[model samples]
Target: MKRGVSAVFLDRDGTINVDYGYVYEKEKLQFIDGAVQGLKLLQAAGYKLIIVTNQSGIARGFFSIEQMEEFHKNMLDKLAEEGVVISRIYYCPHLNGCECRKPQLKLFYQAQKEFDLDFAKSYVIGDKLRDLALCEKEPVKGYLINAEKKIIAKDKNIIICNNLLSAAKDIVGFKNHESY
Candidate 1:
């Protein structure tokens, strides 16, 4: 890994694409407004794009792991067609309380180990407080998306944005500011 290699850990549903609960079909996937552009911006800024999602639906029997993999394949193909490449995707197929669930650091740990990431320069962007809470260590900034600002007021360290585009801009801005 390059020295100072940073990663942007993203939550798949709601943050990347529209959260159709337990989504496992490529035909059903929908990208939120500005999501592609936002992700592209992050990519241009040299952040490794890693997806960390909790797919409890697999454990709930709503969708098989193969179905999820197919869905991800379709999603990645679509992104590739758009010139966006996701570095990796890590998902937790276990039910609640699983070590890899959001708010837990299991997936983060795995990513760090696999990628040799500089957690101090990384960030985690998601639609839930749990996503932000997952990165309590150094260089792991948290960004929350909730236009209504309902679940994030308690955390002063969290940056809240109305959409993915705005969140990307905020993260880029923060990174630039820190470099000065």
Candidate 2:
């Protein structure tokens, strides 16, 4: 565990890739506009990119985790083609009310323990409020990529942005911890 390893945690659906409701196929994967660029920018700025996603489809039997992993590998290959390195990916397969699920601190804390993350200086970027919930327990800052355009957030620890690109810009620009 390193003390100064800053990270930018991201949501998988809608933030990095387009969310089309239980998308689990390689052919169905679509990178959101500026996603590659944004990731690259964050990487260049010395931030490790990590993904913490909630994929309840597994709990619902809509898809197996092995299927998800295959498709996820495909997604990672595409990102690697563009030189975007995702440091780690952690997901919850539970339908709800699980320790590793979002709005819960388990996955983030686990990642923290494994990666030696500096929660105080880290950041979270996602499309939904739960994606930013880790901020409720820790001082980590957050940015919401409001791709859905339907959520009305009032949390002071979170900043709302139009998309991943804008969020990345804010993140890299506010490296000194200016909460957007």
Best model per TM-score:
2
User: After aligning candidate 1 to the native by TM-score, how far in Å is the CA of 123 from where it should be?
Assistant: 0.8
Candidate 2 weakest lDDT stretch, 10 residues? 171-180
Tens-place lDDT per residue, model 1, 69-168, is 9999999999899888999999999888777887788888888889888888888888887777655655577888854645544555678777777788
Query: What TM-score should be assigned to candidate 1?
Result: 0.90
Overall lDDT per candidate, in order of appearance = 0.83, 0.86
**Which regions of candidate 2 fall more than 4 Å away from where they truly are?**
147-150, 174-180
For each candidate, C-alpha RMSD in Å? 3.9, 3.8
Q: Write model 2 residue lDDT over 21-135, tens digit each, in one string.
A: 9868878999988888889889988998999999999999999999999888998999999988998889999987789888887999888888888988899999888899998
Task: Give the clash count for each candidate.
Answer: 1, 0
